[model samples]
Target: MTDAIKIDVWSDIACPWCYIGKKNLEKGLAEVASDEDAPLVEVTYHSYELSPDTPVDFEGDEGDYLVQHKGISREQALEMADRVTDVAREAGLDYHFDILKHTNTVKAHELVHFAKEMGMQDAMKERLLSAHFVEGRHVGRVDDLVELAVEVGLDADATRDALVSEKYVEAVRADEDQARAYGINGVPFFVIDGKYGISGAQPPAAFSQIARQVWAEHKEEAAAV
Candidate 1:
């Protein structure tokens, strides 16, 4: 609604920077008036698969997959991972990429859409990212996804049923289509009020500044009308 600035983010559960971006967004929200002002902001997570072609049960390590899919040498992939790991640390995230089991996150994306239907999308999205990146849990499998949903206070049985029927797959696809239409080719992309586009895992201050600016503009336009 125009009463609140809506932040729509397209991200993948398996992306390290996506989790960091989420945290930074939270920091930004908190920076504006003691976290109470967060109610003025409405955030929605959208689906964007970084590696859609990845098999559900990928048989290799993250470095290997990066080398093959990213067209980078094994050493370069490791270096990149290490560099990101350091960045993640700066965000107060203890990311252990070496133990991370990377796989296709399509099913996980569907699970997030299901949570959105149930009004638990935020919790589900955070839990899924933490499960994969920090806890090293499997996200591509239905059973695992259900477990994560249950942890987020969603009904396990209902989640399992929805997943089995592939109920929210279309929602996930719609998100991907919208992302492409926006010419967004990266994860952790944030759209504020459907007008301002902020790409990548920008600093918390950037998010805070955007939120304040958007809220002011929204107010100004409303006042003018």
Candidate 2:
């Protein structure tokens, strides 16, 4: 049996549920860690852009973007944002959709790839999500992304150079291609053991249950082998 259960998460930085899903997954991991028989957990975040064609500097706020892109009425957009805000709050995130800078997340995904090389991918992901959902920061711009990378203790110059040079652009695209191959059409999609697929921001208990089930299946296969 493998030493750890690998989890590959395909999500977008601008995705609010991705952030909430992240928090819930963390909670679930913590819960499973308390179990003596649980396998070690390893998570890798992959790039998935929900709005690849969005402008780097969108003129309006998140609601406007939703209304325009999602073909929803202005009132429906507000209601949707409010519903997500409450859900995010329950997951311990402070979402400020009113101030969110709805922009393209391709550059942000590239930065995440750079951080993964530097062993700071999780920190970079958390910072980027918070910057967008809670802090209302522009995550699409190179200068702004550089600042965020520095905040996570990555070298400022190297971060800037990587993004400016488009060093991780291919990595970002490769992840997207893989996502398509997996037939994943949504953010916060979790692939457990590279076989079981879990969608959406599931609660902590659900994650714990899945982890235990995977471990059990591994044990059964090992015994048969």
Candidate 3:
């Protein structure tokens, strides 16, 4: 096992629970920050589109999309959205369900891969989620993605060129294929040490406990080696 515990997170910008899971993971890390023997953790965010077929400029709102895709009623969709917003607030995330522009996340995922290449993956992911869920920004468009990347200190022209040329499209597809191999049909899935899989938006205390358990096993393995 590696010295630092490797965490590969599969999430999408359009996924509300994914953002919550990201925050919970950080909170868990904070809870274990003072542990002298805790293994250092390194996270890599992988792409997983919640709605791959969503068009670049979807004409409907999130409620409509949910009704069509998930076969839920409009009222049910709205209720789910409200519940998600309330849950997000408890995790310190402001979710604007009414204004969120529902659209394809392929371009946003590509931008995440581009940001990963530039060592700004975390910033880019956060910016994209904030733009999608909180600010109602169009995450599927090149111009908006470039603007978000620039806001996160990435070079604007380079980002635009990368998007224009579709530099990281293959990387996004590869992540999706890997998720398939793992039989993962959800976003915000966490793969710890490339072995343990944790699904859904678990609580911070759960993540903290898992981290300690993983760290203990890691130490034992290192000693045996």
lDDT of 1: 0.89
Best by lDDT: 2
Please write out the lDDT profile of model 1 over residues 1-225, one tens digit for every residue: 448889999999988999999999989888985644343899999999988899888888878989889999999999999999899888888887877888889889999998998899999998998888788899989888888899999998999999899888899999999999999999899999898999999999999898888877877787888
Candidate 2, position 87, lDDT: 97
Model with the higher lDDT, candidate 2 or 3: 2
lDDT per residue, candidate 3, 1-225, as tens digits? 448888999998889999999999999988888788656898999999888898888888878988999999999999999999999999999999888898888889999999999999998998998888889998999998888999999999999999999889999999999999999999889999989999999999988998999988888888999
Query: Model 2: runs farther than 4 Å from truth?
Result: 223-225
Error of 3 at 18 (Å): 0.4
Pairs that collide, model 3 = none
TM-score of each: 0.95, 0.97, 0.97
Cα-based lDDT for every prediction: 0.89, 0.92, 0.91
What overall lDDT, based on C-alpha atoms, would model 2 receive against the true structure? 0.92
Instruction: Score residue 155 of candidate 2 by CA lDDT.
Output: 96
